[model samples]
Target: MAKDDMDKQPDSVSSVLKVFGILQALGEEREHGITELSQRVMMSKSTVYRFLQTMKSLGYVSQEGESEKYALTMKLFELGAKALQNVDLIRSADIQMRELSRQTRETIHLGALEEDSIVYIHKIDSLYNLRMYSRIGRRNPLYSTAIGKVLLAWRDRHEAEEILSHVVFTPSTARTLTSKEALLSALDKVHSQGFGEDNEEQEEGLRCIAVPVFDRFGVVIAGLSLSFPTIRFSEEGKSGYVKMLHEAARRISEQMGYHSYPF
Candidate 1:
């Protein structure tokens, strides 16, 4: 690495720590002026002012009128709520997911959208020796998996596209949708049907079906999926799996405090 890059690394980390320190100080009270915040965080007044301005622009902090006092905004609470929701969601989803595994004897997954990708947060191994190989914390492309499709399908069309606008569509199999337009079209079908499919898209000879798990506010929070091999695939089986997944997802969503489960 260049000398400039090496020298800048520590500065970047220090900046982050300083920003958090200022936020902590601001959060300790209703509001504080730049001078008071600087004293609390042990930073220069100009430095505190700069960070506050940046946070204000990002909606995490708000300046009171034309005054120098700045207060932390509700944006931080909104982010914290999302984190807490996911924790509750995973704990409650386990019971339903295990039941689905027992019924189908197939690999089951619970995934959620993370950035431009779908991240596997929970999984149940198949009873059979042949099963889809996956584990928690693994990330897969949003354009090539059943869970990914369901995650994007429930969103507004334009918002979904914008989420994936910067992502490079790399095909993992011949069946993988390799463009935003193609994926968008499939998303329409998935949205209408209340489920999504991966027919040898992420990997050859592997098929998966998934349905959405909604939060109490009726927002799609996660996806529940069943995976099996082509050799075991059947039209009737697929339909049954879809029904089973929807049922399991409904129960999981209810456990997370959502009484209404669409499809």
Candidate 2:
């Protein structure tokens, strides 16, 4: 009986994988009708419709206007936001982020690793005329931004290589690091210096400095960053900004019950 149950587990797991694949396909295509979704998932139309109906009932999927096309519902965002709020790092760092912005008069952001991307969970916008614009819930490439680099730099070498394998280094600007080796070297510097810099790598004319926020186990849980316009701060000024950013991140990590490091 135990052997039979073990053997049946693979079929159950495969069913879950298939459902996840269907959801991924729908997400990639943004919106797809039943026929297209069936073809995309390599499942029959009846099977796809049944699974989609189940998902729709669970609030994970929704139909479009009078059409049979399916799209992800806002329920995912609601769940995700609740999860983020419960994260100790985000809760601990919220006050530090506000303080960082108050002191520097620049935008401060908090991000965490989400699969192959970085998800922004909290932000304090700058009160300036030419501040950068980034939504709180957006995801950005991990290899192209300061906050992403700080999180990546905390990973082991082998894990970093594995994560970088999925990253395509499309140059957002001329200063963007395009080569894997270059990114690796930059990560090394970030690890050594306890901070990272985005010199218009993600956006033109904007500069950002970031530091990792570690958990009680010394593992990176999130990243804190401050962003400003390049025209406002020279290289020396940016370096000073990095110093302040690292200090703020250290305070946040301490508030999160991480006390082992002497930061």
Candidate 3:
């Protein structure tokens, strides 16, 4: 809504605005006292204090002592760092993904785990006339995609199981894993081999291979994959393509502050 419309908003919305205003004012300096902050944000001292107390309890704000000033905590900084890392990851992955496209002439995709699916964040189209049909922002089933399998495989066994528990396990193709047990078995292989594959599981006659991209904390935050048609796939070329993907993913992960590449 417009700024003028916001003025006519309900009390809840006004309170939210006041809270954010106070936060913005506090962010301008290292610390702020209740009265000083209230004046800056045009809020009452008691109201500001109430919000500060609530924020402090929530770990968004902190106070040194009962008499000291309120200050913004590291939580906001942590959240911002995560967002920045994702942006940098995509930027770095773009170059590597493009390189892979040139080398193999296949569709390249970078996917991140969302609530219960893998969302494509970036992609490079194949040079050939026959190519995988996919788009950025498309959500693919985690149980049937190479990227999704890699994402799940990198997590703890129990955690991976818990995540799959929420999946409905709808088989998109005849080859798709239709049970949690089967998916878990595939994940075991993915973990052991340090890569994942979709052999006509998501779509008939399509195959995909993916490797994990790690973050600064060495956690798999994304999956990078190459897609191909069965006609274009070769048993001997599988290992070569996997090596290329691993190299690309390693470089991208290193750029994202992860130095130890698993493969």
Candidate 4:
């Protein structure tokens, strides 16, 4: 009834504890039978069977047939694999991002395409106090960010179009691309030039340049970018920033097992 009363309920707490116990027992080995699981978790056969059925229906546990033993599905492994990849990616990009920061004294970001949005997975802050303020897990729109554009540009045309189909063309600034056709045209340019640029598109007075980071399969997996303020940006230095970003991204991509860095 009350919050404190709810916390005093032993049944509710025990159910959760029991579920984790069953999962741990299953994790200790391959397949497990209901009776063996019940004994391992110190639960009744009926309770273990019920939890197994529930987990099975949710795709966490699998059984070959009505009489077969249950085993864990690959969903958990897939999630773990994705997390490991991000860890490896961040570790590999750290050195290069620091180098880029030292060379330009601007914010450096490493972002990956996540279902129509770009997520910052790693970053190096600018030396100046007046730099762009951002965090590692911030998500930015794909239509207005240099990292977003570069991540999308290397994709197959049909796939890229499909991905953009769900993206809302919201303008953040006067320079933002507010139409699918306009973004597509810009993407074509990014694909050809091997980089992407944000000229105060996502935010006023901020400029960013990004290059793609490839994976072992030669696929564009991430984008490495440099962020600068308009007051500090110069046309002559743009090429140098692009060159530095490409070199850092190239080394990171190579470490990721992509030897043929296209850009």
Candidate 5:
């Protein structure tokens, strides 16, 4: 009986995968007719139409007028925005992030761990011409950059090792750490100091300081980072900037009702 059940599981999983593939194909193209979606997903027209009907019933996909084409509905964004708003940490930290940018006169970013990468949720641009180029929807590797390091430092050693198992460490610049051992050592320093530094690791001529932001439950929910040009901060100046960054992160965490962890 157990063997029979296990055999049926693969078929069920394959059906789910096919449905998701059809949805993804529709999302990539602005609007896809039945023929186009069937070709893109390598499924028959009948199968594609059935999947589209189901998705439309769920409000995940919609049909265009008289064209027999399907497009994604706005329901996905409504769901995503609701989830973002429900995160107490993000809601509480917005004002503090603005203040951090005002005080440091540098670009400030708020990022959260998404799967194996960090996704930027908010950004405050620097007043100067030279600044980090990151948009709100950008995702970067978790093994590089200050924000990534700070978030990784908060995880347990076992969890960190697991997360790093599949990370590609291609060197972005001469200063980028390409070895797992070197990254683990940096994580150790970030854990001890309660902050992380990126000395032109992601891009040449740019430096960033980052600290972890925790929620009321004491779990690291996101990272707050201040980025600027390397020419503006000497080694001594970098230390001062690290202090300011740590302080700003602490204040944001406090506003989020996180009082258990001391930085």
Candidate 6:
């Protein structure tokens, strides 16, 4: 934007824009002195130095000792790596979720652990009008959902416990596991069985089945799940749905570069 327009923005907004400008300029070179950076971002030397100081303090930029030059840090690259991972995962999961939708005529979801909850990143709606209500970006409790169980099931016991230590186990339904001890037991069962079951724990009359999708390092990065209503769920048919979800998750894990799918 023009300098005049930028000047009219809220001070907080303008400061953020200036910070990004400085960071972008620094990214184009290994290092930059204040004079060069200010010239590149069309800001004054004092403004550039002030932002650089803040960034440096935050570990996003580094200053050469005894020099007036600043450089980008590895911290930004680490943040980008996390975002790029999710992008690649979704790109690879789209076709697989679609194929599962075509065969099962049920809702399919791709979810990943964010903090202590599972967030849906991608979804394919069921072909039937009676399907469950859900959307991408929805957050579901780890103690009550199939995708959530699959996400925590593959983690180390101590790590999983640590992650859940701060969570409030609010029950979503009468069947929901409302305590850490109970949820941890369910996670153990999920780990042993190679899949997870919601069984109306998340929502009354709705059931879900899930399997893990791994990354190149065999880390369980996401969960692939199929949601159904209790009316359509059966002990016999549950096996078939689990089989399909496992196959789909295995292929998705392969697409993410992990070859040895455990299940």
TM-score of each predicted structure versus truth: 0.88, 0.68, 0.78, 0.82, 0.68, 0.88
lDDT value for candidate 3?
A: 0.91
| Candidate 2 local lDDT, 82-201, one digit each (tens) | 586447667778788888877888889999888888999899999787778898889998888998998889899899898888788889889988988899988988888878888889
The TM-score measured for candidate 2 stands at 0.68
Relative to the true structure, candidate 1 reaches a TM of 0.88
Q: For model 1, how does the per-residue alpha-carbon lDDT over 1-263 read when each residue is reduced to its tens digit?
A: 33344346688877887888888988899999988887888778888888888999999999899886899899999999988988898899888889998998889999999999999999999999987778999999999999999999999888898999999998898888989999998998999998999999999999999999998888898999999999988997777888889888998888877888878
lDDT of 5 by residue, 66-125 (tens): 999899999988878647643666667677778877777889888888778899988888
Which has the higher lDDT value, candidate number 2 or candidate number 5? 2
lDDT of each: 0.89, 0.83, 0.91, 0.89, 0.82, 0.92
lDDT, ranked from best to worst: 6, 3, 1, 4, 2, 5
State residue 209's C-alpha deviation in candidate 3, in Å.
0.5
Which scores better on TM-score, 2 or 3? 3
lDDT of 4 by residue, 115-195 (tens): 989999999999999979789899999989999999889999898899999888989999999988998899999999989
lDDT of 6 by residue, 29-116 (tens): 8999999997898889989888888999999999898887899999999989989999999999999999999999999999999999
Candidate 3, TM-score vs. the true structure? Answer: 0.78
Candidate 2 RMSD to the correct structure = 13.0
Measured on C-alpha atoms, candidate 2 has an lDDT of: 0.83
Q: Which stretches of candidate 3 lie over 4 Å from their true place?
A: 1-5, 9-19, 29-73
lDDT of 5: 0.82
Stronger candidate by lDDT (5 vs 6): 6
- Residue 82 displacement (Å), model 2: 10
Worst 10 residues of 5 by lDDT: 1-10
